[model samples]
Target: MSLLASEDLAEGTHNVKQGLPDLLRNTHDVTSQWMEENTTKEETELNDWANLPHVVLENVFEQLNEVSLLRAQFVCKRWYDVIRHSASLWRDKSFRFSGRDPRDLTHGPYKYASSFTRTFGRYLERVEFKLFSPVTSSVCKKFQKCVKICLNSLIKTKAHLKDFSMPALQLDRSQWMLYREDMCSALARFFCKSQHTFERVDFPGTRANFDDGYKILYALGYNTGRTVTHLDITDMMISRRPMFDIPQFVECFKHFRCLQELELNYSYISEDLLEVLAANLQENSLQVLSTSVTQHDPHNQVIWGHSWAALANRCRDLKVEFYFQRVMTYEQHFRILLPQIPLSEASFDGCYFADRDWQIRPTIASILPRFQSTLERLIIELPDTREVFETELLSLLSLCPHLWYFKMSAYTSTRFLDKLLEAVSEKRCNLSVIKVRIYVRDYDTDHEEIDLERIYTKYRDLITNDLIDYYATCCVSM
Candidate 1:
């Protein structure tokens, strides 16, 4: 028996039993008989309200949605006491708007709850923001208002905005009067309102003209301290104005000494701009840097010339990435800086085709042999061509013994794939993931889609059963 139960039996037997005399017993009996008749009113009034399963009720309340949960809180003081003490019940309810709805009542109501629930919700350790925008101006106004309200609510609650994506967007100047200014204002308001709470910021669009839009970000990054971790700003058309203001922008990053991963999208960066940005980030000791740019043509006068070569040499310790149309020229540039720093991963999307006006495919394959030993992941996004996956492409890949991941897309023939796989049979490194975007018929309308199934089946066996025990391989056709 438990200690309390055993102790209770011992106390009752020793104190109430074997101690009374015969006369005392008879007197006590007479007194008890009299008392039983009149003392019924004085018997301990048993309060059975506390007998209900309170722990079960607490669990059910936790499973309920926001609206149901609020109803439960009003059920009784017992419930209020239980839930008020439970902090984790509020952490999982934070959600972002669909971006399409203007007055979305359901978007972020957790952020707008009473101060008690709000305080509890601030303990959230993970958050994901899925960004979408309205198609028309009327809807846009409503959507913008919704976002503003949500932001206000979040700020009031002091919600921990962990991961957020603005989903980089491109706006046309003709769409509205002072469009850029309005966007900049919105961005500035967003940053200013939730500067401390917002941690990860993703610019979803590949290209954007830098203006006041960038300044708001600069200000936020400058003051937010080390909370920011991953920053993706790839494929952006950064205007020259933003380019000129880069020194100030970079200085802002110096304040965010905790930045780890940085991405630069489609930026035609000059040598000086690159040098400044790299120096600032390196001072902060960033681990990953991804960059994309249109490759310079010898015939075109837009080349960065020797300036880019210099920046590449300087940022040797950084994990550098470059995406371009002509992989050959980019590889050539990379080769010059390869000696200075060990660039481990490189992606070549949209290879040059001689017949399709991208006339540098021949030169690109020649440079692949140079990156064989050091390159970790080599992604080749092929263009639609009759003889795109030629013998020369397979031969170039055979040189990379250290290559862990290899992928090709856009209508590569089955026979060519077999040959390529056969060639890499022995030299295959520690490949873990491969994604292939399949070819589909072009559509004039917006409803067109790619055949993901066929692409997966084509390379299914090759990627499914990976060689490594802990490594997993996956392929996406679209």
Candidate 2:
């Protein structure tokens, strides 16, 4: 009886609801009708985008590149507010200026890169200006003008930058010398301004001098000495000339206590200089010290065994990598390479010097064993003047367990490959890639010298394989 009474009550409520026409309309339908009646055209057309939170707008703005961001800000007042105030989107990006850029070229070094700094200089953190290349003497003056404009704009809108990469201009020899001083003066002032926050400074191949009591470098070292971590001022002017002073440089080096990676000229590294560096570098931070070798560095016959050993002792992880600008004479090679210095990655562009009088074959293998525990990569570019026996090279490979990549521009043979594969399999060597540019002789031609000359031509040399270098492909594939 109670169940039947409950069913009757439900039926009564359903009938009541249906009886009232106003109640028949759902709450959603009624609300829609009310909104249609009361809302104005302006209120209805309101964009839902304006309701987005500040965090969401900043995130969306951050996705855009500099130019795109600049454009997006003009979309509305809300977007402009977000982009104008946000700091993360502006700092730590690379801006390149080139002749190809569409900016008004007649104005200065480059408006494309400088324009960004000029607009948002207050939010600046990392600024890198990479100039357009293939410059001639006529365009250098314009280049100088552009640099000055860019520098002036950057200085005016001064803010501390973490990374600064001033272009190492590749102008004609006379042209570079003519404008180098003006560039350096501007750079010194820039460096002074950047001293408080300059963490990593790279002015490679600029040959920036330290005359006038080393003012440019002094500002960098003395101001941010303990803070600067990665300094790569390679090819700096530090000679026995009237303006250059080695002792002052040593003092400057003393200030680099926090340096982790350094690349300077091999000529400047004397006993006293390296000693100061070894003493100053923080523990384990100084992993790799790279230097560029010029032909003249061999004359400075300072025994680096003790000083390098001291550095190695302090930072057991230190590895010294040197780049040879020219074919190294055998005596010069021996003089510079010290056993104490840990060499992890080596690039020997040419092993033969002066009519094959100095070849790396016999001596290189003997020297390889010393760096067996450390060496991981080796690149050897040999002139095809003489055919080298693979015995020494294979022996070196066997000793070096860590070697991952090996590239040789040479005459490789079947016997060498067979031995190399056998060695790789036997030792389970860590060697990952083996690239060899195999030189082929034209047997069809009767003139042997002519054939050899044609074979040795820079880019036309066909490999033993029809495709890529068989030596590299075979080793990698296997």
Q: TM-score of every model?
A: 0.63, 0.76
Write one digit per residue (lDDT tens) for candidate 2, span 1-478: 6999999999999998877776656766988888876685555465456558988887887888777998988877878888888887788756555555545345543455567667776687887765565244444555655666666777777666778776555432465566767766766776676537778887665555457226667777877778888888675554455221357777887877788888877776777877887788787778778877765433464656988888888888887887765544566667777788788877776534434465666456656678888898887766443457588888888788888777776555545655665565455455656666544444332343343344334223233222233343111110
What lDDT does each candidate get?
A: 0.52, 0.66
* RMSD versus native structure for model 1: 12.4
Off by over 4 Å in 2: 1-46, 99-104, 134-158, 170-172, 209-213, 238-245, 296-299, 351-355, 383-385, 443-478
Model 1 agreement with the true structure over 1-478: per-residue lDDT tens digits: 8999999999988776666576688999999998986675444232233234767656666778877876766666777776666656665543444444654434343234333334554555444433345345543344344445555556666767676565634443333233445555665675676647555667656244555546666766765746786777654335644343345544555555555677764333434555555555445355666666445322122335354445445444456565555533433444433343345666655543523444235544655566566666766665544335456666655666666666656555445544544443444434554444444344321222222334335546654665331221222233
Best by the TM-score measure: 2
